[model samples]
Target: MTLDFDQICALLPHAYPFVLIDRAVEVVPGQSITALKNVTGTEPFVQGHFPRRALMPGVLMIEAAAQACCLMMLAGHPSPKPLYALGRVERFRFRSPVRPGDQLVVTAKADKVVSTAAIAEVVCRVGEVEVASGRLSFGQVGSA
Candidate 1:
């Protein structure tokens, strides 16, 4: 399945400036998702992150990847959406700087899922070059 900007917004709780994923190109319910984020010079972080050289922060890249994983996990859920929280991030590595005009393609695959949590492997790329990659653990909100 594919998701547009509005659809992405509906699946996520984040708002403008924080909403990272622009669109989901592909999605496999309860399995994986491939999403996109178009980096631009207009992003608020560019001004303060580096006034002279704008680079997308590694943390934000992880955030984007995590969001993609959240989408994948949420795809199979029923209505009255369950909240998802970042439980942990592991083995995150930044391979290159992501700059303005770069189209970030992020892919996330569910590694494992239990009654209260889920683990996913995620990666972000600019074309064929990998910009960031990591594993993320998400906890189901209000679950123990």
Candidate 2:
């Protein structure tokens, strides 16, 4: 099932332009998720992130992927008390520039679930080619 940005906000704490994941394409409990972001020229970052050739930053790509992981985390846990954090990023790469009008798709696979933390393998892609991939770690901030 897909969750719109408002629903995403209901699930996650991120807001506004910082909420990189536009919507969740697929959400499976304790498994994996796929999310999407439609890049646009009107974004705040594009205004000054090189006005001549505005492009989405690579870090934002990772953030989007992380937000997808956040979605999956919320789907499984749903406690509303755990605050997600980025613990590590491995094997991440920015293959190409993400321009306006491009649709960024992020896929995340839940791999590890510890007593208080979870890890996921995440990939960010524009099409078939991967733009970034990494291992994302998240932890709960408080008790249920």
Candidate 3:
């Protein structure tokens, strides 16, 4: 299944400037998801991250990965209010810098899933090169 921008906005708790993902091109309900994030030169963070060189923050990549996992997890429970949140990130490595005009392909696959929590492995890439990889744990929040 594919989730468009509006659909993502509804599922992701982050608003406007904080929403890290663009769209989800593939989703396997509670199993996995593949999402896309377009990095642009004019993004607010890139302007202040450096004067001459613009590198997307590694934390944002992890956030994006977490969002991908949340999307996958949420896809299975479409009627509920948003609850899952990134609880932890483990064994994550940033292999290269993310630059403007680059498209990040983030794929997350479930490693474990429970009623209130989940763990997923995430990998982000640009073209054929890997940018980051790790495992993320998520926990239900907000009245779960």
Candidate 4:
């Protein structure tokens, strides 16, 4: 299924300057998801990350991946709302720098899921180039 910006806004708790995923390109409930983020010079981080040559921060890349995984995990749930918390991030690697004007395609695939927690492998790419990748563990918080 495809999720547009409005749908994504409803699914995630993040807001402007923090909502990393721009759109859900593809989503397979309880399995996988692909999301996009259009990098731009106007982004707040660019102002200080490097005034001369702006680059997307590595941490934000992982945050984007984590958010994608959270969406993937929530897709199959009966209740549409639930807060997800990042429990762990492992084996993260950044192979290339993501710059302004780059369109990031982030994908997350489920590795395991239990009563309250789930794990997924995530990767971020700009076209054919892999920029970052890692595994993320998250869990439902409070009431569904």
Candidate 2 matches the true fold with a TM-score of: 0.91
Tens-digit per-residue lDDT, 1-144, candidate 3: 999989998888778798889999999989999999999998889878876999999999999899888889877584656588788889999999999999999999999999889999999999999999999998998732
User: How do the candidates rank by lDDT, highest first?
Assistant: 3, 1, 4, 2
lDDT accuracy of residue 38 in candidate 2: 95
Candidate 1 ranges with C-alpha deviation above 4 Å: 142-144
Candidate 1 lDDT, tens digit per residue, 1-144?
988899889888778989999999999977899999999999999998899999999999999998888788776577767778999999999999999999999999889988668899998999999989999999878521
**lDDT of each candidate versus the true structure:** 0.89, 0.83, 0.90, 0.89
TM-score of 3: 0.95
Off by over 4 Å in 2: none
Clashes of each: 0, 0, 0, 0
Candidate 2, which ten residues in sequence have the lowest lDDT sum? Answer: 74-83
Tens digit of per-residue lDDT, candidate 4, span 24-134: 989997789999999998999999999898999999999999888877877667775677899999999999999999999999999998868889999999999999999
**TM-scores vs. true structure, each candidate:** 0.95, 0.91, 0.95, 0.95
Model 2 steric clash total:
0
At residue 85, what lDDT does model 2 achieve? 78
In candidate 3, stretches whose alpha carbon ends up further than 4 angstroms from where it belongs are none
